[model samples]
Target: MDLANYKNAYLTFALSIQQTRVVSMAAGGALESFPKNLPRAHKDYVVDASAKMSEKLKPVMKGVSGSSFEMEFDLDDGNPYLLPLVGILFTHVAGLGGSPNVDYGGLLKAQEVVMLFAHLEAFLADSIRVICLKEPRVLKKNKKMQWDTILECGSWEGVIDKMVDEYVFEAGWGSIKDKIRNMRSAYGLEIGVSDTVLNALDAAEQLRNVLVHNGGRVSREYLERTGRNDVRVGDMVPLDGSYIEKLSATVTVLGGDVFSAIAVKFFGARPDELRLVFKGAGTVLE
Candidate 1:
């Protein structure tokens, strides 16, 4: 639409915000601040500036939407004055460059473009929150293994010694060894504890010792790294993105049930439901 038409509409809208019975006029209040009946050349200048603003903002909006977040940017409410100022500045620049049509109106429209971008960005953030809440399994399915079997086996020298003595004297080596192996096999897990988990457990144990015996200063970092294999010694900043990514990985390990919601929302099909449509030949899980 033409700049005048848009201006009129905007003025009406702004007035509607305040009171309807007064027949609000854009030529007054904030509107009175601008030139009347803006020249086409001036409108064109603003349109171009607006286009530039839109171009700059497009990527931001796209990023937010893709990430499942919701955000909103309203130029009218957030920074109405600044937006027009930009248009006016651009117009002055164009005029200085010998362009007669250049004016602040174009700069004002640029504000709209920025506002549109912020609004969409906010919307994307909001969407991510909604999607996340809908898929609590994102966190639930990614269960942390409480203990490393291999590590436990390796470190529990005293326990193993006692058990071995009992087995040798009472249970017999053949039967006891076979029983242990069988138990491990049944759980589909190795009896040999994982080195990673073991390391984490050791760190945790050390932290516990320090805190209890030495009065070590407790911090969030200490708690996080205490029993962790990849623990770093220092404060840790909260990384929501990393947390979500980790959650996704954990869910994937737990049969990736969290992705079902993503598929349903994005592709309009549940994982299992899509499988049926794809047929028996398709791989259901990666």
Candidate 2:
């Protein structure tokens, strides 16, 4: 991770975070009240139309159960019902009269938090691959590969690439702590993440797990991992916009910290050099 490589990696990570933030903002905006500042008459007409559409959808809605349903479409024969049904559902749900039927804003925020963590995990894994590729000695103690797998490689670089891929794949995306420990033990890269960032990342990881595995319901595992005693095991995890913003900021800071640490430790980057690189890359480190 020389100055060039460090700049490239940090900028790439920053760009990815920006891209995710843009998408999250767009989704959040879409979840807001539609047709803002509409006249009263138009609002009344929209609400009336929605009521009528709901009535018409009664038969189709009756068949829908348990939060979702599956429908098959034949490509050869154009589906006549899809667009009209979508329009009705969209109008009905987008708050033609008042608030949406469901808390789509909260759901979208939760989803954004989950996606942020996913991007962080991908960056961590990619960092590992980049480091191992640069210094094969870091993987000297890596697990031995099968003879057939090695034989399948056309060249030594391919074998090394495959070996690195397997090594990272086997490591698995555990908790932030687990990932840090794996990096230290496997690649000897000590990523010095701050307590603030570490706690936030751990909490975000637990939240993501609960949302994905436990239907966003707080569990004892999440409480223990996050050290959060305010909410009981059965309570729903709080995923408000403010919390999501905090998590997003934490992710950006942690990414910068990790990248800088690797550059300094492995590539002999100085403090001044790191700062200059970050500045040149238009990355403001808080």
Candidate 3:
């Protein structure tokens, strides 16, 4: 197989790695803080002005009820701070004090990570394009010219060019599912990114779309799209730092795995060029 032909796609795969790394590094500090730096309610919940004098009672100095709110975050791991942070923000927003419920910094960081993956998905499209072309199942050019479609001056080579061009270029080149399907059909390549990664990508797409289109309120459509049984309509989806970190890491690793898999299948070994640049290895090929 001629490696030079696929060099452009390989470069794109490498560039995707660099871009994701930069984003991940920039987000590293933000994730380390996780819930510690995230918003937290005062240990003693404050009461409204009407309840100020009554609130001073020994039994109820600040809060009226201990279990006024409850929240659960189903993530890759159980974080002690996750529920507390959510409670604090929810209480603040629900009118415990005034206006400090929303963690703007954390939200922005999450959005950035989501954007990073969105861009990565596009880059995956480019990688898939090259992988399809290099597939052994792909047929050579056909120069069959139609009765009147072919011009008198055009050679049968032109027909071959058209066939190759249309076949090569007409693969559904946008959607992630489309790219994955093409790889599978052409050569049975399976892009085995984890369920966590897929779920995160799904969440990111929903969050991004909601924020951009509906001002960040989790709509029924968002709920339907995410399919997270726990999340309800009208719930606010916080862009948690930890969630973003997991997503970024998963996608980056998955991209490398995909690159390595493609190289191994096509070349019967890890390509020297891929190793020199992408250093991609350990793609579970079947």
Top candidate on lDDT is 2
RMSD in Å for model 3:
13.0
Residue 27 of model 2 has an lDDT of 65
For candidate 1, the lDDT comes to 0.35
Model 2 has an lDDT value of 0.69
Every candidate's lDDT: 0.35, 0.69, 0.54
lDDT (tens digit, per residue) of candidate 2 on 50-130:
555556557656774445443333323343434544554666544474433556577788778778878778778777776
Residue pairs in steric clash, candidate 2? Answer: none
Per-residue lDDT of 17 in model 3:
48
lDDT of 3 by residue, 48-154 (tens): 21133233333432446553533334433434444445466556646676744455465566556556556666556555555545552364445455666667437
Ranking by lDDT: 2, 3, 1
Question: How close to the true structure is residue 219 of candidate 2, measured as C-alpha lDDT?
Answer: 96
- Against the true structure, what is every candidate's RMSD? 26.1, 6.7, 13.0
Question: Over 4 Å off in model 3, which ranges?
Answer: 1-107, 135-178, 194-200, 229-231, 271-286
> Could you say which candidate leads in TM-score?
2
TM-score: model 2 vs. ground truth: 0.72
All candidates' TM-scores?
0.20, 0.72, 0.51
Instruction: Kindly report which residue stretches of model 1 are placed more than 4 angstroms away from their true locations once superposed.
Output: 1-102, 139-286
Question: For each predicted model, how many residue pairs clash, with residues at least 3 apart or on different chains?
Answer: 25, 0, 0
